[model samples]
Target: MSSRSILLTGASGFLGSVLLRRLSTLEGNSVVAAYRSGKDEGDCASGVLSLGPIDGNTDWSDAWARPVNLVIHAAARVHVMSESEGDPLAAFRKVNVDGTLNLARQAANAGVKRFIFISSIKVNGESTPLGKPYTADDTPAPLDPYGISKHEAEQGLLALAVATGMEVVIIRPVLIYGPGVKANMRSMMWWLCRGVPLPLGAIDNRRSLVAVDNLVDLILTCLEHPAAANQVFLAGDGEDVSTTGLLRRMGASLGHPARLLKVPSGLLQQVAGWAGKEAVAQRLLGTLQVDIEKNRRLLGWSPPVTLNQGLLSTARHFLESDQT
Candidate 1:
């Protein structure tokens, strides 16, 4: 493959930051780090072209005046506490739907070869029922505002591709984790670091998680892989781990024994709902597993980093950040 100019949205975010670093080290690749605010000077690499703030007001045609061979649409209104409190549907649509459509239209006009969308597995559903996992062929039935927005974005992108003869690739990853992770995963890491005992040892719900590196590798593969075009893939580490198992592994990575006690799931759910953390509880204790056989067979991609290695790397990052 020849050198490609790739525009990466959300370059300062957790996943984007990791992708930016990886892209910086790759040969024959130029990156444009699109931010929704001021440039992150500390995280910007030598080859990264920093462009600030791309919202509804920003003229994308002008912003994307330069030739961009590929676009990885990673920027979106992520699901968080502050976001969920507001009109979540509208808020998510503003960025995940509108922003994505704007960029795809501009990319199409610019004759960009491929548009890679970083969607969430929540587009399928929140949880997988017993004895079944979600596959790419399954119809999307998003359960929340965030998931709905991503599904809408996927539809828009696919429509644009069909109309313009462009290629679109959608990657729905489940619970991505690694260095610089935030939200509940970060909280979990913090608790484990402090050796705080958790009452989640009894939960046997299985969830699929993908490492940052694995996701990045898949993104790169989709950039050039012919089979990836006009395809949707569910990606993960191919190993489902329960909440308790994950905690134990995390403790092992941090060089500490797992500090967890058996707690009834129903009681925990009630307490979480009382505390206005029902969503958090569901995610932490939910059984959302994804089947990655399609991605494996289609792209021939497997997670490069194992669960243990990924956990250790994340633990090391927390340690380093704490010291600094």
Candidate 2:
């Protein structure tokens, strides 16, 4: 964490962009921005490099402009709602697994001290029984292409760490939400802001979520903490909220009523099955909590932002963005 040069991948992405800004502003930290496509006009990094279409064969010769102290690999083939690929697992492996190993090997060769991988909670299976939250020690049971790819990448990174002595820190975060969040979290916010009546009021299941800022804080901690090396840490806000509670909080933050109907969870699941939206229903009603006790005990780290604060920030951003 001293005066060191850091190379950051996916610098223009949602979470990555916020990390880029924060890393760039820190005194004595020189940040190199790496993106896959067009240049990020708002990038404040000292160095910018384009890594077009990451895969097994990406040429990363330009990433090492200086002696890099760390590499935060945030780029990957993320999960999509409607996958267009003919072979989704193969496609994900090419990028998330192969692309990650390719970069890590190169970073090790270049004498990079540490490599931080942003993994997902999906690596620990889909859902947990209400109170039995997933721990970092849980057996990995990735069900989808994206999660499998991440699990493979993590295994590869650990092997590379042993072989090359480059510290590997893997972080599995659950449902990260904050300003500029997209996908389902954003969609939920949109529904709340519009006062749409949702049938999720009766959901009593627990879901753990981490704010983007909180995840970034943990990443920064891992970058320097000695106890973080070669360790897998689960990240969350440390507060589990039911779907109904989440909607209500978001509604309050957005200055709107959730307007949620007290529909029974069983009936909703049945209806979702009939509509071929069982996957969506499971996410809305099922339990997917992660235990962050390892994070607290090892790194003395707790989420810097509370759930309410995070939701309020996200809601304010949504309102401001909608106006513009």
Candidate 3:
């Protein structure tokens, strides 16, 4: 692969920050890291050329004055609380759909070679019916606004690729966990660290999570690998960890024994739903697994970091951060 200038959206996000750090250390690669607001101090450390608040109207001709070889669209409005109460479709479409098209249009005009989109497994569905795991070939039947928006964006991207002849690679990754994570993941770490007794021990639901390091590795491989061009791939660690098993491993990583009360799964679900946290309960107690054999066979990619290693590193970061 030729040394190329890459434009990375969502440079301040969890996955994007890690990718920026990795990209900075590589020689002969120039990165244009875009963020919606605020400057990421880490960008300076990573030597990324930072661009802020870029929208559909923002003139990217200046940034693309030189040849841009790749564009990684990682920016999107992720899942949030109360999808029913808000117009999440508009919110997600603004950034995930319109914003993506804006960048892709400019990149295509600039003669960019590959456009790698960091999509989510939610595009498949909120939950897999019965016992089947979602595959790359599954029809998109997104349940939430965030998922719908991403699916729409995928369609737009493929359409743009067809019209402009730019290679497009869409990566739909499951729950991604790593150091410096926030939201639900951070909450899980907090509970484990405090030894909060969770009722999830009884739940036997299986979910797939990818380590940030492994996800970044796959992104880099896709950047240059010929097989990745104009393809959609589902990415995960290939191991399905049950909620009980996940908390147990997390406890080990946090230097604490698992403090769990094996409660009835049905009762817990009812209570969680009644408390208006059905989404949270479903994610924690329900099964949403993915099969990644396609990624392994097609790209010859495997997770470089194990689940234990990733969990340990994440726990340590939280531990150290809490002290400071």
Candidate 4:
């Protein structure tokens, strides 16, 4: 591969940071990382560019000073556990939808060959019935504000691609786990480390997840592959795991076996509903698997790292970081 000039957004985020580091170390990749913090004075020691807060009005003149051949947009208003905004949908649309289209329009005008958008499986729906997995061909049915925003952004990007002739690649990945992971995944690790007995053994809901390494690999593939242009793909590890399976595996990786007490799924759901935590319970006891056959058929890609390998890496990082 010849030297390719690539610009990446969300350089400071969990997924973006990993992708930035990987791109920076690869040979023949002239990578420029774009972040949303204006506090940093000029370019940093690592050559990351600060674009301030990303929104519809954010400027990208500095990034376009040099020719950028490709763009990987991984930044967005991610889902929050405690949303404080008065209008949650409007808030998400401001960043995920508006901010994304703003960047895409500029990228098209600047003659960028490809723009890769990192989307979420929520676009398909919240949960799936047994034996049914979400595929790229299915009609989008985003339920929440965040998923709606991403779906709208995808539609806008595809329309822009048709009008401006700039190729667009959309990837919808399920729950991603790896080193430096936070939120529920990290919480699970913490509980396991403390040897807390969780009443989640009887829950038998299948879920799909992607490793950071596997997702990054797919992103790199979409960056240049002719087949990836103007296409949407679902990404996963191909192997589905239940809630109990996930906890047990994570616990094993952390050197602490999960102590799960078998509890009826119905009782857990009912109790969670009464406490206004139905969403959280559904996540734990819901089936949300994705089919990644498109990725394999089109790009000939499969998750290079297995689920166990990814979990082990996350556990090792958690241990090292916790001790420090």
Top candidate by lDDT: 2
What does candidate 3's lDDT look like per residue over 55-141, in tens digits?
A: 556566765865678888888777777555466688788878887889889889989999999999999988875468999989999
Q: Name the candidate, 2 or 4, with the larger TM-score value.
A: 2
Residue pairs in clash, model 2:
none
Runs in model 1 lying further than 4 Å from the true structure: 42-53, 82-85
What stretches of model 4 exceed 4 Å from their correct place? 38-46
lDDT of 2 by residue, 78-99 (tens): 8887889999999999999999
* CA deviation > 4 Å runs, candidate 3: 44-54, 82-86, 129-131
lDDT ranking from best to worst? 2, 4, 1, 3
Model 2 root-mean-square deviation = 1.2
Q: Over the stretch 1-324, how does candidate 4's per-residue lDDT look in tens digits?
A: 878899888877888878887887778888788877764322322356787678899898788888898999998999886899999999999999989999999998888999999999989999998779999989999999999999999999999999999999999989999999998999999999999999999988999999999999999988899999999999899999999999999999999999999999999999999999988998899999999999999999989999999999999999999533
lDDT of 2: 0.91
Score candidate 1 by lDDT: 0.84
Global fold similarity of model 3 (TM-score): 0.94
User: For model 1, how does the per-residue alpha-carbon lDDT over 1-324 read when each residue is reduced to its tens digit?
Assistant: 588888888888888888888987888877777775565743544344455455455466544666788989898888775453557798788888888888888888888999999999989999997558999989999988999999999999999999998899999998899987887778887888788889999997888999998899989889999899999999798888999999999888877678998999889999999999988888878899888888889988888888888888988887789422
Distance from true location, Cα of 179 in model 4, Å: 0.7
Backbone clash count, each prediction separately: 0, 0, 0, 0
TM-score order of candidates, best first?
2, 4, 3, 1
Measured by TM-score, the strongest candidate is: 2
